[model samples]
Target: MDDAHRTRWTRRTLDWLRTEVGSALLLVGVVLVALAWANSPFSGAYEHLWELPVHVDAGDLRFDMDLHHWVNDGLMVLFFFVVGLEVRQELAVGALRQRNRRLVPLVAGALGVLTPAAVYLVIAGRDAPTGWGVVIGTDTAFLLGVLALVGPAMSNQLRIFLLTLSVVDDFIAVTVIGTVYSDDVRPGPLVLAAACLLALWLLGRAREWRSTPYVLVVVVLWGATVQAGVHPSLAGMLAGLLVPAASPEREDVVRAKHLFRSYWQSPNAGVARVVGLGLARSISVNHRLHEQLRTPVSLVVVPVFAFANAGIDLRGGALGEAFGSTVLWGVVAGLVAGKLVGISLGAWAAVRAGLGELPDGVGPGSVVGGAALSGIGFTVSLLIADLAFEDEADTQAAAIGVLVAMVLSSLVGAFAFRVARVRFGEHSADLPVTLTPDVDVERDHLRGPAGAPYTVVEYLDFQCPFCARATGMGQDLADHFGDQIRYVVRHLPLEDVHPQAFGAALAAEAAHRQGAFWEMHDVLFANQARLEPDDLRGYALELGLDVERFDRDMADETLAERVRAHAESARASGAQGTPTFFLNGVRNQGSHDARTLIAALEESLPEAAVRRRS
Candidate 1:
């Protein structure tokens, strides 16, 4: 297929995934089917299915694995690649971008991992040291699903905290699997693997811009890692790390847009193809690959893995023995008790040390609930169990523990969250949420007619992806409602998490001085990963602003203070995260996507509130 066709297909696939939340549901269904099949009279058929031999032979090169191992080691490589991309993006642009913001989660995740292992050792004794890695990870998919089901009534900051904590722990767990679990290291293959990694990094730094060499290197690196007795899956993470996470250079973006515009006017197929490819390249490699791969890995690969691995039969003696076994007790205690106490205490200590603060509208109790939620560790936990226990009986016992811990942890978290809700009442959630002060046509950023019947006060961070999406939706709403809606913008730069956010907010504020706040907003969101001082100044110059005045305004303490004051006001008014919108003085619930928000506006406002677009 041609480049344009491929791009269109990829975009459609990603769009579909965004609109559907079927992955977790599908995984659950597959697990249920696996369980039924395993306990049926045809249980031998289910067991034999996974043990069926698979082999590849090509001259001196050969590989052999059972169906189950292939699913774990071969198919799951894609899943790990997507994970690596996520971690890379977080470090480059998301919550982990700042060292101080990362510190709390770092501490929490370390303690979460260590405490669980420690608990496992204590319960199972030194004889079971090998299985101690079983309780180290959080199931991101399941946890995020639970949070979504619980809704935005909970503090959004808690969700972010849990997400960051899980991501850090997942990376650490992957590292442990790669290094600690490997049976032996072959020196020659290990050295070659190191060389391959170095070459990949150098190629990325040199901006080779071609995929052929990178793909070859990745294939070789995976093989080398496998030969070295390390898990080959680590190669995916190494490759993802080498991917550049910044937007393309300013010149490159300009050139690509120019080429696209030229092709638009002339209608040349060849020029259009080249422009398509160039536009694709303008996006970061990590983001591009992530967008393409996330849906397939989640929907197909993950469910397939669960179907193969989640089929432990609960026969008469097996179930009773597993319940009685020390290994099972260790797994349960490690994941349930260990994660809850460890993460909660870590957060508490972080606050005591002044290293971290709780999310607005969330208290210490809610944090403990969030800690309980962290105990649901199925995906990565199963992986560790498989690697740790070579004996079939031991592995089955460990699996039973993981399954029970997952269910118990989920229930405990839900119950704790309920308790927090009842105890804190309005304190646990943003209640009677109202618009932050300083949201005004005269004082703050404004879009659309000031006298319009509908007013949306958006507390936004210039660096946030969701806020960027909300900004675009705001534009569409303006176009849809004509002059019947007014948009107000307030700065709530999550500076601690997003390092460039404070500076970006300042730049927009400075541009507002030159009557170009919206122009600067567009530039910053379009190039979020490339928002250094020089880039901000260059954007001002490109937009025909006085460079000297823009720089002076950005550096002005009063302007910065104004932005900070607005942020503080937002926090006081119960804002937990960015892109929070208040429509007519009431918080907007649900997603801010164009369709959803438009319907919400229609319901919230009167029939005569909007003027239909001509």
Candidate 2:
């Protein structure tokens, strides 16, 4: 095959691996392979391989660790770095951006961790208190995969709740490992580590998106932390947080454009390279690193860690040894029973006491199921088991408990998710969607009167052929119902699938400024197949819009953000696809034909409200 085909195939494969189900399956498969290898006659090979040691010394610099330690203490740092990046993104722009919005997850996750650890301490305290931390984590990839297995009956709320909970869980786990579990923490090295962190912060400001100084500082930070007897992986979080999450300055974007134009016009190799560098700086460093590392971490680093760590011999009475033992059963109880009770009750108390609220569409049964699934604490639990136990027997027994807990937890979670799907009748997860035609009348385009009794809100991509099918529905709604129902258009562009969708939305938005949004909207949908950049400008001219102002408005990044915010609002409010409609604040699912739209309007709107057109 050609290089292009090979590159495309590689991209597809990496994307697949980065998905929840794909990562989960790969992780589980590696674990299975490890189990099989450890149990087979070739078990000696597995043990010997992980036990192999490597050492490095260069003048004053020295590093020594075994293959297993390297995987756990060394490679796992990248995994934690990715976690830090995710948390930063959430706090910076995603769901947890707002303080009140963050409260629920923070409360739920805090309770989730404390309850599990408390349960473990109560049950295993006298004999195995150290194992408390083992039950405190939730494996995000595995939990998400389990949810995926339950099918679309799972709502986005459950996914978000679980994800937020896991991010918090990981943070707690790392902090616990670094502070509570480290037996030899020295203040001197810790002070040095803090100095390195200061250096990291300074370097980040001086050279945004430059990895060299950051890497050097992080390397020293890791060594210092290791010397200080804290888990070296904590250095990764420190490094990750230093990477900026905000958008770059406009000058940066302008510089990138200049470089790109220079490269295009002059066609020099150096200019082309500078263009690449400039464009990289224009994007958020957190996002760029996250994307660059996700595939490799999911496909390579995680699987290797799982393979090295998950190998517990099932042969030679190992099952009997663990099944009959208190340490094993205590861990199982803590993970399975403790997580379920903790997440459920913790969330309940938080919600009841006004600290948190249940996510939309998620009822008690779904919460119970989700809580049970959080018990599948594979990655961090295994790490805890390693840290908490010195004896091989104890470690293997804890591993067995982790394995059993994971299996049982999944079954329980699936059962709960299925129950939720049946109880809620599949639509329980969707939030109520409403759009006030008068609210964003100036910001968004409106075809009919803002105060029409029955306002029809259409969330759609301009390039969507299905949206094109619904194009006539708007005019027909006006034609049939007259002023009784006014049509309002909102952009929900899917730029990945349709490259021109965002540009089309921008064209429509720009036209709204010139009081001709409907005109641009009509033409764009009609000729979606030809919405190139120049075609959009031509459409503005054809519609008699101020061409220069239209161009300036289209070029406005803030307008793009407005369009993006609208799309995100559409998603968060549970508009599943393009051509989604809401009549009188209620979503109208199914066919978007005029008849369906009219029928939905009749069913959803009160007669008094409909009669308000007079």
TM, every model: 0.79, 0.73
326-400 per-residue lDDT for model 1 (tens digits): 899999999999999899888778778988665556567677777887888888888888999877788889998
Estimate, for each residue in 25-142, the C-alpha lDDT of model 2 and write its tens digit.
9899999999999999999999999999898785675678889998988888888888888888887777687665567767777878988787777866787777888889888888
Report every candidate's CA lDDT: 0.79, 0.80
Q: Candidate 1 lDDT (Cα, whole model)? A: 0.79
Query: Can you tell me which runs of candidate 1 are displaced by over 4 Å?
Result: 1-21, 150-155, 208-213, 247-256, 426-434, 438-449, 456-481, 487-564, 570-614
Steric clash count of candidate 1? 0
Task: Name the candidate that leads on lDDT.
Answer: 2
